[model samples]
Target: MIQAKAPGKLYIAGEYAVTEPGYKSVLIAVDRFVTATIEDTDTECGSIHSKALHKDQVSFVRKEDKIVISDIDHAKQLKYITQAIEVFEQYVNSKNITLRHFNITIDSDLDDASGQKYGLGSSAAVLVSVLKALNEFYHMQLSNLYIYKLAVIANMKLQSLSSCGDIAVSVYTGWLVYSTFDHEWVKEQIITSTVDEVLIKNWPGLHIEPLQAPEHMKVLIGWTGSPASSHHLVSEVKRLKSDPNIFGHFLKSSQLNVEKLIQAFKTNHIEGVLDSIRKNREVIQYLDAFATVDIETPDLKKLCAIGEKYDGASKTSGAGGGDCGITIVKNDLNRENIYNEWSKNNIKPLRFSIYHGQ
Candidate 1:
């Protein structure tokens, strides 16, 4: 049996703009994770079981290099898992390794006990975990970069607009400054090049750098009790591409503020970090106003206000119609106060620490 897990992630800064190639974002892997366990099967067929998805096991088989799930009705629910299997199979085949049937089980802590998502990049984590398990099962000894590339390709197969910074955080597992690769370039290369060639080649504009959080800094997360669809909000933001001025300003300003935030982290400048956070929040607000999209809900606004009142820098974490907000503070007292205020406003404070992968 082989078991592997990948952590969920939160966007600390750079959300709407990071989708564009070369635009940067900062993210942290959280303690919450999606775990995948695999066991070899003696039969020709295998099954997939996920606690977060279906209640029963879904049978599957390989059909001419593709994994086909028997339960069509629930197959879509396991798209990430199946897509990961397909991509991993490509890599395994490239190595001349013959695949065998296996039963894979998935468990997730990226959500509540009642199974509500926290918008913590659950799908990305799932794909990473599945790939990790397969990597071990085949003794592929794949590098993190290889697994990340495969995960990105699998994700792009489903959602073309994704920045895939979440996958980077999941695969690398720490605080990271990430920039998107040119998706069009990868998509085009995938058609003409083998998976091995694509993995070995340089991905234009892609970057991932790890960072150490300052000892004096504390990160606080508050849930708005309302889950937002990142895809929907991102797609809405994409519509603004029709207007070059507004969208261009959003991209440029977001890049600048994110760069400032990254520099502050590198220099251990807490004040600079806070200022950049505030500025980045303003940039997102500008985007909200012009795009006429609800990036920040009323609860998120209250959450940030309380954080600022307590002298902590705060903002909505992701695409943010409603999900989680992050608050960065210098001390525990301010964090406690922000949590108290969040509780008073019906916001749930998630006690998740930064997850550094083993």
Candidate 2:
């Protein structure tokens, strides 16, 4: 069996700010995942299959003499798998490896145990798994860095809201000080000690909700049901960055937000992280027409109402049309009660736990 898995991710900082050149966002890899398994079939053709219960997406295959697979019907799924395959084909063609039939299955632990949240980089996780599978099956010596860039090509292929941070975090799991300006990849430290050490005495990887208490922290992830697209607005934001005034304001705001989050992590102050996310949202909106420049969805308002009562901070997570939102818990909030309440409202609260890379 050719097996592969990719960790889901979330933006910790610089939500819509990643569209610009000098801006950098932060992302974390979660324990939960989306995996793909491909088994070689002796026959000349194989099929693509997905979880039975998941009417969520269609299962398909682009059959040929040798197995060629793609599930591009869902526009939002991105073209990570297809792109990875295309890239891998280049190397495989060099070796003249004859194609073989195979059966490919994609299953996400996200839907099974963790309720799939569009906000957490579920799409990215799936794409990464495809790339890893290709590397394994084709004997391609692709490194994590190459995998990252290849994924970026696929990310921006259909979506322009990439900050390059999500894929980055998915690859190099753990705490990091990321920036697109002065420090591109500084303080690339891993916070997953399993046994809290240095900077963090009780470092717990990312944790999901309605589950065991995290060793380090617990964050609340919310969905907007409808979110304004971040791609267009982010691209517009990049154009504005060309203006001196807009550029300065945008850069300064992002820097300030990062500093605030840093302080929160430094003192293990949940409130600090909450406040920073709240503040960052304002800055993103300040870009006017670049972030949430359109109609605000009720989901945003509803989740905010529920999250405000909990703790830390609550804000929209990604390409923010009305998809999903996230909140960091602060004090002694009742995790169970709120999670149940959210579910009653058709809102799925996920238990997100971070992962550490070896």
What are the TM-scores, per candidate, against the unseen true structure?
0.98, 0.69
Could you tell me the lDDT of residue 49 within candidate 1?
A: 96
Residue-level lDDT of model 1, residues 92-156, one tens digit each, is 89889999899999999999877788999999999999999999999989999999999998998
Q: In lDDT terms, how accurate is model 2? A: 0.58
Q: What is the lDDT of residue 105 in candidate 2?
A: 69
Most lDDT-accurate candidate: 1
Q: Model 1 — which ten-residue stretch has the worst lDDT?
A: 50-59
- Model 1 residue 44 lDDT? 84
Which candidate comes out best when scored by TM-score? 1
Q: Candidate 2 residues 256-303, lDDT tens each?
A: 786777666776666666678788767755665443354234666567
